[model samples]
Target: MATHFEHLHAVSASQAYKATFASHEHTPSSSIKVQCPIEVSFSDDTQTQLAYFLRLLKQASQQSRWVTFIGHEALVDKNLLQSAGIDLNKVLVVCNKKGHSVQELMIQALQSGNSSAVIVTGDILDFTSGAIRDAAILSESFAFVINRQAKQQMTIH
Candidate 1:
């Protein structure tokens, strides 16, 4: 798939870019990091999910980069992921309680190219497709956890 940033830039209005880019206040050292959020279902013994995370984590660790995780429940799963071979420091946890909006987190991740991957919970499902698309435009890969409960939110209508 095309990088998130590419997709976003393709559709984002110059005004929107000016607003976001202006707020960023780029510095001489400022850099852009790309992230692509992938949504994965969490089921019994999520070893496969954990393994996927671990593989990415290890690769990023090798490059001295880290993966930032969003959500409280996600953090719990990440703990289990450690057993699958994740480096603790290479996995930074940021719960929603930290009072960061998804957009804020994405921007922070983009600025910190040191993070190779970013994982967020289904809470992000509430964002407008435009926002998610924009995030994809800015990221290399993005991971989203779509819990079984989330599917129940759908109506038969």
Candidate 2:
């Protein structure tokens, strides 16, 4: 699968560290000092894109802090989440209502300093992504955005 993962961390990883998932090598979580937003663009299907999110959600759920997911209400499945080793009690799904954008809610959640991580799925404009990044930095937390692949040459619009 082709996965375009961006800005997952604020700094580069040590050369010695590695992870098994993709061609990308990741440092150990213990070694990571700065948290940031992760933007994922999958060149595969939605199923593959969701797998990337599932892996992240599972890791975030292990923390004692709250793990929040903004929007994607139609896709959240109890059985799937439970089966993925994600603790339901630690998870909170926020649906978009009351006329607020999903990314806006995500920024709020990240800056709140209450959750270990905030996740959402959609195309994120660079400015909004930067805001989310800054918010995550302030709160010392993680933010994630998962985007499905589009036909033709893809741009993060």
Best by TM-score: 2
Q: State how far residue 55 of model 1 sits from its true place (Å).
A: 2.7
Clashes of each: 17, 0
lDDT of 1: 0.47
lDDT of 1 by residue, 32-147 (tens): 23323444444444435434445444444444566677655555455556665667767777766578876567556645555655655554354335555455445433344444
Instruction: Report how far off residue 16 is in candidate 2 (Å).
Output: 16
lDDT, candidate 2, at 89: 94
Q: Write the per-residue lDDT of candidate 2 for residues 1-157, one digit (tens) a residue.
A: 1222234432211111112132343422531133445554444333344465566667667777778888764234788779988899998878777888777888888778777768676654532457877787677565665553331223232
lDDT of each: 0.47, 0.57
